[model samples]
Target: MTIRPIVRYPDPRLALPAQPVTVFDDALRDLARDLLETMHAAPGIGITASHIGVSLRVVVLDLDPIDGARTYVNPEIIWASPEMIVHQEGSVSMPGVSDEVRRHARVRISYHDVDGNSHPEESEGLRAVCHQHEIDQLNGLFWIQRLSRLKRERLIKRFEKISRG
Candidate 1:
């Protein structure tokens, strides 16, 4: 597996919605493997196809090695609990800064494996947060958009300062 370069923030491609993965083949599998390697290199728990400039609706998440890595193709949040939770969120695209993001405490998502087999999963806690965060990226919604304007602005400034180094 190759560690693909991450598409950093402010790249217009990150603002565009990703296309659903329709073909389940070796190439798709390779993409998944590459994503896993890239995420590990980024030191992020979750990442999406768009993170690597691939406009496909694929997500790779490795929240814990004990649970193993999970690949979700065309993942969509089918259910979200009314309860909310705040978790610190960051992006491979925008490294060096993170802020608390409010999200559903629990969520049920429908997606397919790389082999095209459909599956439904219910997640809570950090897993649930990761699901929402990555799905939003797939939908062209950056995590900072969920923060207050002031927070978003401040975070961007900090990110800019870091980027200049």
Candidate 2:
């Protein structure tokens, strides 16, 4: 599996909504493997296809904090509990900064497996949070969007300055 370049902030593709995976073929499977490799190389907990310039609703996450990875193809959040939890999150896409964001504590999601079989899973804690975050990326949204408007603006500016350097 090859590591794809991650699209950075300010890229228009980052805001463009991703399309659903239509054909669950070997190509799609390879993409999933590449995503897993990319995430592991980044040492990140999650990654979305949009990050690699693929406009597909696919995400890979490894919240194991031990030894496992989960790949989601066309993942959709089926349910989210009202209970919210805050966590400090960081991203390899944007280094040297972490942000505290409130996320649903529990969520149920349905997606296709590598074999193209559909399955549903319920998650909580970091798994739930990372899944939600990766799902947002599939929808062309970032964790920064959960922050206050002022904070979001500040972050964008900071990233812009950093990119200029």
Best by TM-score: 1
- Model 1, position 101, has a per-residue lDDT of 95
Reference-based TM-score of each model: 0.99, 0.91
Candidate 1 lDDT over residue span 1-165, tens digit each: 999999999999998999999899999999999999999999899999999999999999998879899999999999999999999999999999999999999999999999999999999999999999999999999899999999999999999999999
lDDT of 2: 0.84
For model 2, give the 10-residue run with minimal summed lDDT: 90-99
Q: Model 1, clash count?
A: 0
The per-prediction tally of clashing pairs is 0, 0
With candidate 2 superimposed using the best TM-score fit, by how many Å does residue 161's alpha carbon deviate from the native?
Answer: 4.4
**For each candidate, what is the lDDT?**
0.96, 0.84
